[model samples]
Target: MTYFVYILETMNNKTLKYNLLVKQFKNNIYTYSLYMLRNRMDADDATQEVLIRIWNNIDKFNYSAAKSYIMRITHNLCIDFLRKRNLLINRELEITEDIEESFGDESTESNPYLVMQMKIATQKIKEAIEKLPENLKSVFVLYEMQGMKYIEISKALEIPINNVKVNLFRARKKLQEELKIYESE
Candidate 1:
């Protein structure tokens, strides 16, 4: 009877920890997947698979490195998904509608011109990000958009720290050049 109670307690504690970890990283996983996969449906599927993998491997990984571990899984899953579907060519840019809707407030709604300009600017930036090469895009998304540190990006992408720095630098330079062209137009 005592052993049964101990088992129950252990299971409950593990479940609680798993829930917290999932909540903390779910959005990051989905966003990374979305940027990598370039499709909402595929991203959703990838996110679900990541969550399941996390739960399955909960006992195997250290909680201290959970972020990198989860992100590594997400990155690999997205890559596999892309490869399986042969989706490298003709990739369409998926500008998130959430960004546009988030700009809607009492003040912004009052100025239709401002709203339109904001959406256009947001669209252009998203398009620029989408146009980046895969290496640059992954580094950009993980480091800049996902707010991950250099070490974290290195771990997640399985790249050297120096490579992470170089890729991020190149991503920023390319984005700047792309956006500059848009500004000129």
Candidate 2:
């Protein structure tokens, strides 16, 4: 059963609207938090906190760039959570490079050995990213992985465009240097 208010929009209507918004951005928030926090629990908590922030600030949402606005809120919430959690990996992430995880029991669809090798390479990439400082990591995550433009990142992070560009440049250089070991293998 559904209830409707006589007013233009009811409380239920507001709930539905926010629910839709959450559905649209939930995955993005979780993924960003996961990469930043490197822990499922913290990522989940950050996503919930960000969603709560969105709910509380629904009226303040900028209709023009709602996606960016929501993402900005998410980014802020995630960074805050990370800072509170000692700004370091409190829990070790159990990244699996197992052959079975890459290839199922049947293993007929793909080569298990190649899949395992790829998983190892992927783990190394994650390790390199994790080595980045918080500032560079945030910028790298937004520009490289999240695909935000420099201006958008600047707005979201409340930093200048030039700073965003500089951080991204430094981050890329650091990553290149850190991952150079793989090239020799």
Candidate 3:
């Protein structure tokens, strides 16, 4: 009776901890999915699939490495979703911009001109990101948009840190070129 009670308590504790972990990263995972998949419905589906996999693999998980593991799973699933479609022609870009997330000097404010300009710029940026190659886009989204560190991205994407840096650099350069017309006078 005592042994069974201890086992039950341990199992409860593990489940509680896993639930907390899931809660902690849920938004990040969903946001990543949204950016990668570029559609709200697909992002929601991908997030659900990723979380289910996380729960199923919880027993084999180590807490410290859980984040990278989860992200890796997410990246793989997103790529798989893309591959199964056979081409990007079937993928639709979600036009709603999350411009409220300030990227350094860019501001989402109440001024009409500023707001209009920001919207235009945001649209251009979104187009630029969408046009990027998969390798560059994933690196850019993870490191720049998702706020993952280079090392974290490297681990999640299974690429070298230098490769992450190079890809990010290229992604930014391409965006600059693509959106050059939107630059302020």
Candidate 4:
């Protein structure tokens, strides 16, 4: 019947959209989760959950605002994961395990001394970021690392745009102070 054919076509279209959405945002979700949860396994679980939620609510969300919507889901899920594990406070991230992945591929330089220096600098920066307060860390990671805009972060974290700007500023200041201290040592 015509109705049956129409239903099948709609389902196919939805499936195609969902696939494209996943392809676009999966890395972002996983990266956010990795920073928030600070564990590979937990990040993986959170990414999977976010993807599942996106699929389930595919028809309900506006694709125009899809990035914020998807990131909000990811942020919430990461918070829940942290709370469930009682890591909301006194959280310590193992920076060594995925440091290369978190930052990027290892330097391809031929100079061993330069590569070593780069790795040390990267590790120090990562440690400083890990030491930031949760509020600042969230803002810093979302803006600097995830390439999210102020408005996008505000919507995703359910904070005002001004708050996003303030938090990002504070995060940067704190990171600078931390790096300064490291340099002195």
Candidate 5:
């Protein structure tokens, strides 16, 4: 009963509905800001800004297009923040192939070596990801971590889909190179 009313309020743009909308989008807003800023304080600030904008503009929201609308807002805000910092933000990202290969369902109980190897590989991959250039890192996080399609990413970044593909390819190449060095060491 309460849940249904909340939804109605949200749809009808009541004061209660506005709060409900904020509750629903809060996690996504925080996560998006965190990914863009890579700092908790800045992410917090971004989240507040997004919430304020959403609250003030709730009347403009169309239920059918709400998801895409929110994402566009987040994407634009991130780009604006980056621009203000004079950063050449890239949206490409690479994941370590070796980590992907090792991700099969192997039981640690059956083979201790497999468990240890998985742990080490996971840590190494994380380290490698952190070391990647910002462009590759962003692309990797957006595609792999956030599970956004290349087309969606292209729209968000205002880049061509082909550029998204190329950036992903280059990011993968960088990851492969880093993995090779790790293996050789």
Candidate 6:
């Protein structure tokens, strides 16, 4: 009878621990997975896999450094998935600025022509971002589009914060130069 009680208590503790970890890591896992996979279906699969891995191996995770550990797992899983699927479309520049223009906030309401120009500008920006190196591209995508912080990106990539800043700086500069060329045309 004492053994049975011990087993139940142990199981309950594990369940509680898992629930807490899930709550803490869920959003970061989902967002990072989605950012890397770039497709809803693949991201969904990756999210499920990440959650399962984290849950089953939560004991191995250090509470003091939990976020970095989870992000590393997510990053590695994404890379593996990309490698296995051969799905990293290198510099494809597939996003159209017009798509973003259509969903613009109130600034474009006064002038349809201005909105068109803005769309063209945005499209050029998208193309330039697509043209960035893989490392720079990932940083830009995570920080700018996905709204992740420099610290999170640094942790996920295992790169220095200075490197993240430099890459992001270069990405913005290159994109602005590209947009300038578009405007001059």
TM-score of each: 0.86, 0.78, 0.77, 0.84, 0.59, 0.61
Q: 1 or 6: which has the higher TM-score?
A: 1
- 1-185, model 1: which lDDT tens digit per residue? 45433443356476876787788899999989888888888999999999999989877766656778889999999989989999888587665666666676744447888777777887888888888888899999998888999998899899999999999999999999999998998
Judging by lDDT against the true structure, name the best candidate. 1
- Candidate 2 deviant stretches above 4 angstroms: 1-12, 89-91, 94-108, 182-185
RMSD of each: 5.6, 5.9, 6.8, 5.8, 7.3, 8.0
The global C-alpha lDDT for each of the candidates, from Candidate 1 onward, is: 0.84, 0.74, 0.77, 0.83, 0.67, 0.71
lDDT of 4 by residue, 1-185 (tens): 35433443356487887887888899999988887887778999999999999989987866666778889999999889988998777666675767566434445535657767777888898888877887898889989998989998999999999999999999999999999999999
Summarize candidate 3's per-residue lDDT along 1-185 as a digit string, tens digits: 35433443457466776677678789878877777777777789999999899888877775665667888999999888777756455365774545544432444336667776767767778867876778888898887877889898999999999999999999999878767745653
Q: Worst ten-residue run, lDDT, model 1?
A: 1-10
**Candidate 5 lDDT over residue span 1-185, tens digit each:** 46544464456546776777777667766766655665556667778888888888877666444444665677678667767865445443233443455554565346868776776878677656655665666667668766778876776566788888888888889988998898899
In the range 7-123, model 6's lDDT, one tens digit per residue, is 433564777777777876787777666556655567678878988998788666565556667777887888888888887766233345336645577454678677767676666
lDDT of residue 62 for candidate 3: 57
TM-score, model 6 to reference? 0.61
Q: Give every collision pair in model 4.
A: none
How many residue pairs collide in each prediction? 0, 0, 0, 0, 6, 0
lDDT of 3 at 16: 77
Model 4 sits at a Cα RMSD from the real structure of 5.8
Tell me the tens digit of each residue's lDDT in model 2 across 1-185.
12221221344466776876777678878877777787777888888888888889877665446557767887777778877877566456544433336445535667868766776777777777867877788889878887888887888778899998899999999998889976776
- In model 4, which runs have C-alpha deviations exceeding 4 angstroms? 1-12, 100-109
